[model samples]
Target: MGSVEIIFHGAAGTVTGSCFEVRANNKTVLIDCGMFQGTRSLEALNHEQLPFDPKAISAVILTHAHLDHSGRLPYLTAQGCHAQIWMTAPTADIIEPLLLDSAKLQAADAARRNRRPDRMALPPFIPLYTGDDVTSCIGQIKETCYGAWNELGNDDGFRLWDAQHIVGSASVELKLADQRILFSGDIGGGSAIQCADVPLGGYDQIICETTYGDRTREPVLISDRREQLAQYIEEALGKNGNVLIPAFAVERTQIVLEDLVALFESKRLKPFNVFVDSPLAERVTRTTQRHRLTGYDLFSVPNIRFTHDVEESKQINSMSGVIIIAGSGMCQGGRIRHHLLHNLPNARARVLLVGYQVAGTLGAVLRDGARNVRISGHDVPVRADVKIIDSYSVHADRPALMQWIKDRGPVSGSVFLVHGEQHALSVFAQDIRKAGLAPHVVVPMLGESWSVSANHAAKRICPAREDLQVRIAPRDWTASLAALKSGLADRLRALPSDAARERVLASMTRALEDAESIRTIT
Candidate 1:
């Protein structure tokens, strides 16, 4: 038997692209073949060469249907990965339309860019994959119910638990070479469905997400979320303006729809026109309705319409007193951008952002209070009332994450933290150490590999490049530096002789000046 090894291919130092490879017993298994998202630099990584051969992989286990976690499967399929893609039934049903829509977007973008008159004289843009590739990838998917164990290869087995981050999301538990390793796939909070009391302990080693490792959210209840949403809808309607919500197709759209349904069903709000603008979100919403658990029919809301044609979508822009939920949650593409272009400059309109917007996305720009934004080759002024309710976030906050890890009863091995920014990863690693929860906690970088033995001892085989190491202090660097300066000043004042104090202060000033004058390259 060979040593069980894990290689981090993505989501090591950022919040997206979550692929990992586990090798043992002469067989290899992949977990979550997600795509790199957000910044242009990160998106470029999507076109880079994959680290491992696709054909060599035995199987793939998917955690959910979100594009960042499942977007690259078609590319992998195009590259000849014939391994059975495993996921829950809901995920399997939803991923098809999502991936196909992704391909359509890619092809459309390339075409649009090629048509530009000022385009650089470069090679014609080619999409990463086509609609056919999405078909091929969907054909390989095999569904399994949650909590059922499935054998992957000799002496290797895995199971999935409800992660509650979204519908059908899961946390994987794998047994390989006599050791158990748990992979936390974007855990949600206590209020999420089927995850209120998720099992967090009892694994030899844990590979966990730290997406919210450095922050906490306000204590906002579901009632608060619904109340606020109702107020926004009423206020917009009163002004004879529409409400635009740029939502993720899979989970966020469903959640918002459910809340809206509940509000009208309870007679708290009058029935009004609600349009689902994106075809992808509409399809996913229908699939979600079919996959609804017993007695949980959320699609029967009043005054709701699903617009699938371009003309139908265009009609919504001129309508007032309507609620439009559309996708490309980050406002980077899709029908949401069109809706934003129309409504953002209308002073009476309202735009509510519900999901996390990464740094460079249009959603982030709007959230940061940019008065003018470029959309579809035009600059549009932001005259609408934009509100962000972060309480709707699905990812668990820092305290929740710590509690989740601590609930894992007495892990004997180290914790490998992934899926967070450098700041969050560094802060969370130190927090784990200070709490004495683990003997060692590592925030791995891209392409780093580690070996785990049958006894659960782990050793890193490849270190991150020296330049990529996040060397910031655990406490805020500015605060820590200021505290050090204050302590040094006090100690200098305590010196027995004025001459000695003056000498030390002068030396410190010179050192500070020298530090300031030094130039460093990133």
Candidate 2:
């Protein structure tokens, strides 16, 4: 057998964007081609040239339909990649609406930016991929079942196993020549109300996600989670306020709806109208219902209303004492931001955060207790009660990840960790060493490559990009600048007199001038 090489293209040092390249037997396949999220600098990476040639890839094995894991497929296809995209049936269905919605959002954002009076001499903005590109990408997708191995000729193929993270999420086991490598595609905590437990198997080498590797969540049962949701809603309603939930359109929305249905059926929650205020979420809910993936009817309840148009969404602003579930889970975009802009200043309103908020996103700012935030060019004060329900997260925690890794063990080669922040990756690397789960544990950097052989440990073949570590830092410079601007404004407003504020501004200007002069001298 010849040598096998794997490249960490994305999600190596960052929490989102999960693309990997695997090559062997004169064939090159991409595991995923996702988009970077969070900071603007990170999202800008989506517009950069793909590190590898898309035309050179023979096939693409998708792990799931979450945008971070599948968003860039259209961009790949736009760049002339005609490779067959393989995924579970549900992912194939879900990605249609997801990709289309993403294209629409990008186009709208670009148009909005271009229309701005302050755009000045900046070049006209363009979306990364258009709806026609999404159509082409969708045409290339081929559906596969969960348990059967799909042959790729020359004794190379792959099998999909349920990841239990979402409706059709999966972990992939790839066979190339004589080597077997398993890719843990975002493992679930195994307690999700909508999905089943994760399956275990042995592999020669493993590449796992470490999204929650540094922290262990408190164990929560399905009933307990629902109860907590009920209490939060009730508390908010008691104050005669609406409960706003910023949820992802996929598993998070479905799971929240499942719990809500249970609570309503059991009469734990009083009769209150629950609005699902995202068009994409409504589409995903219908897809899940068609698949019969969840035990509960996600959208058929009497009190549940799925708003489909801007008019319907705007109507929610006048309502009170209800629960609103909106998408763009990080509160970065989508209807959630609109909801927050209207409700955040209301002292009676409650903003319920039920998913992981990457650093520098609006959700993280709220989660970190920012008293005021800039939204849609308006500075909005955050007086609404912000509460987080960690149990609602679908990603596996440290304990679950360790158990999953151990269950897939007896591996004779290295176990590579990806899809985590720098600190989580560092902590998980040490944890794997202490547990003795594998002979070697590797934490790959973005764009790094490794050579693997059946008889030897995986060895690094190339160094990662020099600026990758800095680029993937928890908070980017853009977020810092925004914070600095907000803080400076607040400080200026609090000055005793206009003269004092003027003096502060002058001093700041002199300081910047001096700094620029020093840089010029250097």
Candidate 3:
């Protein structure tokens, strides 16, 4: 029988595009099929040839419904990954609309670039799959609830625990043979406006994300932030300011709507006719209504005025003082761009940013207090008041995350960090050292794997690992592998007696005692 291996198919040194593969019992399973986002060179890596074939996968275990974690499923399934897709009920409901819209967005991007799918060098740019592909992908999904353990293949099993990032998000615990490897999907803040609790751990190899790992996102009293946002809108509305909020299509859109509704009801802000201007965002809100009957009860908020038609969306801008929440939070694309193009150059407008703005995005420029921003084809003056609130983000910041980790089960394994900026990861690495968790803070690179085994499962493989796939043909690899494989095999055979066998076994145990697995390549 063969041993298990966890391969980093995505979300390596750089964040986003989060795909990881676990191969055991000669069956392959994927965790989180997400897309990579960023600069052209970085994004191009998503389209680059994969080290492994897509069709060989047996199943996909989704962590959440966020586009970054679920976006690439359509493309992979289109390429013939005919395995059962497993996720929480809400995640399954969410994947459908999100992927269909992402496909539409890709097609839109291709059309604007005036290029055929065949001409784009971007990964999955080969038409970026179709709406049909998304439909096919959705049809294969099976739902599993949090806190349940399900067997996937052979004796391999996993427990999907609450991650609390969004509705239906989960952190996975995978059991391979006798070994336990925990893949901590994006951990969430304990106190998001919506959702609850992070995962507890008893992991041998903990693959954790650090999106906000550098420093704690200091506490911002929710009431204070909400009041600040309400006052910003009220002041802007008094001046006839068009409040343009670049909101995420998922939870953020609903939060803004509910928050605004409360403000209006409380007489904190005048009822100035708010507009939710993205069709994609509208669909997500509709889907979120289903969650109201379950664990996600935030969608039932009254007085949310969503505009589904383009004409109605355009009419929102015609009105002088209106609140517009649109998708593409970075103001990179989608309905948000159209709103920004029309309102950002005006003196009587305010932009409320309540999400992370990656570098180079229009939102980032505004956050940096830039004097002007280029929108569509013209340079627009940035006369609008730009406001940011951390209370709105769903993920836990560093301090909150540390609290969860502190309360989790014993840290008997190596802590392998994933999903954060390099500098931010470096800072967290230093912080963890101060927190006193050991077995080394391993900063894993893209495509690097470290072998982990439970204390009871640790054993010496006599044949040595051969026929292992190499991403690139390694020089001197054949000679080194041959020598090691031969030497290890010879050592096993040369143990001539029970006494010698005991000696070998004792040495092996001693070696494993101090020999924690840690491989970090930048």
Candidate 4:
């Protein structure tokens, strides 16, 4: 019997980048080719050499259109990977605008950085992938449907099941020889809309995402979430301030629109200027409307303004008592930054966070209650009311994740966790073990590989790379601590007193000595 080997390339430890490779006989397949995001250290991995030759990949199965899952397609194409990309029809439609917008953002960021005259001379800035690369990647896409088996060459095949994370998200079932492996791309158990059904009791091995594995979310009723949103809008509008929502262009935007519409239709919210600011989000919203016509709507709201031109987007800043929904969900970039710049200092303004914010992202900084945050080289005061509603997230929580696994019956082979932080993975792994849901549970590190046979036996043939050990290491608390210390030192140095300088030095020495003591004990 032939053997099937699966490799964890990214998203094995951290939550952002996601890539997995499966090989059987002489053919190879890739599950996802997402880009690294969040911290600069992690984002640098996007420019690092890919672990395997992309050209050798025979095909790729995309689970959804999220950047964290499909952002690197253009980069892969640029690197000479000519694999046939497969996804649902909606994913195909949504990814087109998302990728092109990503390219534009990258180019814009590079241009902005190079314009600083005080900057030291460096190599010319280049985007990760150009517009042509995105076109090339789109040309290779082949659409598929839910519940249909498609061949992956060499007698291995896969079936896509709706993952319910987004409009076209899916979970994959790969059949190799006598063994069946299921990949849970991203599970959306607590979403506002109805998620696709979860398949049960058919696979030998399962790879799952644990984005919310460690935390149990409060069961948020959709009506309650909508009511809360209405209250926030009313409060902001009463002060003649605008309400800004930095949302994902995909499902998040659609769902929020639906909620807003429901509130308006129910007469719970007053009629106001609702602007869909991101051009990409506008296109996505249109696509979602078409899908909704086919009985796949979250909630449809009418009388919203869709702004695409730069002048129109700029005009939004001058408007009052408006509700604006824009992209760059984490506030790392995009039009959301411009809105934040204009509204953050306005005490009457409200910023509603409706998605998961990665650590080190501007969204996280705001969510963590930073009194002052740097934006476009300016320190913006956090005067606006910031509100976060947990129900808006698309990922499954810990209880839902565990129940999903349990409902899938017993896995004869093993369970592997990905797409989560170290703490979430650790907690979920323990939960799985304590529940005895699988014979073996592995929290894979990046570059790790496992070989599985038809008889349900699996062996680890390769360990993770030592150089990329940080990819699997526990969340870098040291980095955060160092940043805090550095910021404090800078503030102390600006105190214009020798006593302040001495205090900085004294604090630094104490921290270093404590670190040394911990290191010695470890």
Candidate 5:
């Protein structure tokens, strides 16, 4: 058995920006390189040099495509670290657009500040990464299937499972000799139709998210959220004040669009123009459509006027009462901030938030009913009514999280609670210990190491199968087709009807093992 060291560089106390490094002797694999997006004091942390030399890192694994989980890659690659990014196919498709768009915005801001009217009087805050950086980062993708054990770098291997948070999201299980660690990037309950079937697995150690770990949100009935949004929009439309929604360009934007379209379809709303004002969101919608070719969609809403250029977006804002969905979901930075400045001072307008608003964010302050918020170095009075639809949060609640853990059986190693606020982690830690685990709880601080004692380490070891881990299938009879089915569903889902007719038909044969009940972590 080998010893491994881990560091909790980000997402330790506050949420947003998740990064961790696992070191096994000289080899290290970093999981998730998300950039911090919040207050300048905190976001400045990303601008500081990486804690460890990026050059020493061997490979990187992505939990999902959320900016908090994968945002910092362009900076990492630009600085050093030329390793491949391992993730499921859906993750690969989404990351390209996200990274590229993020980089473009960063470059634009840098240019704008240089030419600002107050350039002589004000100091500049440069963007963390550039478009050139994203171009390089997107080329390093290596897609992996779920539920498969495979070697990584020189001395490590990991098994991926369906996390169901996002299209390609997975809970990663890493093996380094006798030690293994499981990372829960962000988990999704079966609440949304797009989430894949949750998979059950074994792990020696587990690191999970506590975004909704503190409270069991009473199951948010879909009807309630729809009504909340409809009521807000209906009122705003009646006043003819613009409704500015700061939406994440990924699943959040798509779901909101879906809800709006549903309202339109049901004749519950008027024929007002809806503008999706993020270029990235437009591409992400295409990615969503690509997934639909396989018959899976997380609320496919159609008919949006995608506005990319600044002038076009400005024009939409100038023309009163248009519903605008813009990016940088939490309102930290982006064109959404510009749109907010105009609509927020108007009593007829509304600012709608349908996602988690982190602390130190304009969205959070607004959600918490702040009368005024500072944006772009200016404090603006809040005249527009702000509405928060917390039910629409993509992160599963406490009950859902608990069910997912229960379904995974007795994970016999150290379980670390992460990707949540300190309060959330504290409460969940006690509950985890109650589940009868060996050294059940670990809340790792930045750069903490967990090494195994030779006396306590397990002796069982599997021989390495190098090339097959990356190939179509491993040359082993013990591995079942059912495991492969869940791992490569996207590939299978995209197979031609005639070409994969028999192979696809064979996958429908469920084994007795499939009868195992899924546990929810709510």
Candidate 6:
């Protein structure tokens, strides 16, 4: 039996990026090459040089089409990776649009930044990768079936199992000589109406995700969730205002549409004009409809209108008492931000969040009831009601995750937990030890590595990257800066006299000067 080594390249202490490198029998393969998301400091890592050489990788196994798991594929191809990328057919279909949209967004953002007057003298910003890179990467992808084992050269192979997280999501089982290891791509909770339950199996070693390992959610039935949505929409419309839903263009948007259709068909919801304002969401919805998995077209409903152009999307802001669904579930970018800028200060409007928001994102800020937010460099007051439906989260909760782990049980070697915050993974590790679910459990840090053998415990080799330790914090300086700006503004406005406001501003200016002096002296 050949020895196997695994490296934790991403998604170790933080929840967003999801890359891993596996080496066996003089061959190397990458499990995923996801992008780092959330805070600006974290996203900045996306432009840094990859720790490993892309040309050395033999093949890449993609688990799904989500940006966090597949965003860096184009970047890899741009860096000279020529290996065949393997994924399920559905993933292949969805990623083409997702990656292309991502490229466009990046290009647009770079152009916007470069256009700033302050940035005119600085080096022009460039996108991480272009549309051409995405096309090149897509050309290398080969579709594979769920149950069949495909050879990876040198007598090694892998098989795919349904992860049920999203359309075409899969958990991979890798076979190398006498050893087998499994990678649990994001597992789906039982809330998805179109996906089946996750399948289970045993392996010598397992690498699992702990996205929601610290908490167990209350069970929410489909009917109950739909009723909750109906209530929120009705209440918002009753106040003579529109409802804005910022959703992910992939599974979350489709799920919301399906529930909306169900509510209308059951006469639980009144027919209101609903605008699907995101072009990417529209494309994804069309693709889903083509699959015919839901037995009916979700976009065929008479009340739902898809806006195909920028002018049509802009028209949505002028309408009242209607429902608008947009992309970028986290409120990071896209048409949702424009809608938020327009409606956040409207006392009668409502913002409904339907997915997990990373800790440093604008969505998290609004979900936590921030009264003022900065969107597109403009400060906006939060007069609209912001609500969240936790039941809509696609990730499995603690109980479901534990149950899935137990089902994949009798693991003879070790279980490595990744893709979660530090606290979540730590608590999960403690629980795993209490239940004796595996012989060994590891909560790996970013840049750490382990060697696996059939009869021995997994051995740690690579040390964690000290530089990355700061990047794992839930909130970074960007969030802090925003809060500071908002707080300063509010305090200045609340002062009883103009002199008081001037005094506060003068004090802040003096502090900044003193800090600058200290830096110069040091």
- lDDT: which candidate is best? 2
**Candidate 3 residue-wise lDDT, 350-388, digit = tens:** 998988775445676688887665555445667788888
What are the per-residue Cα lDDT tens digits for candidate 5 across 397-471? Answer: 887777767765467656677777667878887877776644556665443445542224322122222331222
lDDT of each: 0.82, 0.89, 0.71, 0.84, 0.73, 0.88
Estimate the lDDT of model 4: 0.84
Candidate 3: the clashing residue pairs are 47-123, 189-396
> Higher-TM-score candidate among 2 and 5?
2
User: What TM value does model 3 have?
Assistant: 0.79
Q: After TM-score superposition, what is the CA distance of residue 203 in candidate 5 from its true location, in Å?
A: 1.5
The superposed Cα distance between candidate 6 and the true structure at residue 272, in angstroms, equals 0.7
Candidate 2, residues 1-522: lDDT per residue as tens digits? 567899999999888889999999988989989988888888888999999999999889999999999999999999989989999998998999999999998997888778877675899988999999999999999999887778888899998988888888988889886788899998985542222353455578899999999998888899999988899999999998999999999878988988898888898987789999999998988898887556777656889999989999999999999999998999988889999999999999999999999877899999999988877666788899999998988899898999988988888788999999888999999999999998989999988999987647899999999877677777888777667766678789999999999999899899999999999999
| Clash pairs detected, candidate 4 | none
Q: Tens digits of per-residue lDDT for model 6 on 119-153? A: 78999988999999999999999999787779987
lDDT of 5 at 240: 81
lDDT of 4 by residue, 358-398 (tens): 87677887888876676765557779989997789989999
RMSD of 1: 10.3
lDDT of 5 at 252: 85
| Shift of residue 311 alpha carbon in model 6, Å | 0.9
| Number of the candidate with higher lDDT, 3 or 4 | 4
Alpha-carbon shift of residue 124 in model 2 (angstroms): 2.9
Candidate number with the higher TM-score (3 or 4): 4
In the range 159-258, model 1's lDDT, one tens digit per residue, is: 8888878878988888887767889999998643343354546677789899899998888988999999999899998888989999999878888888
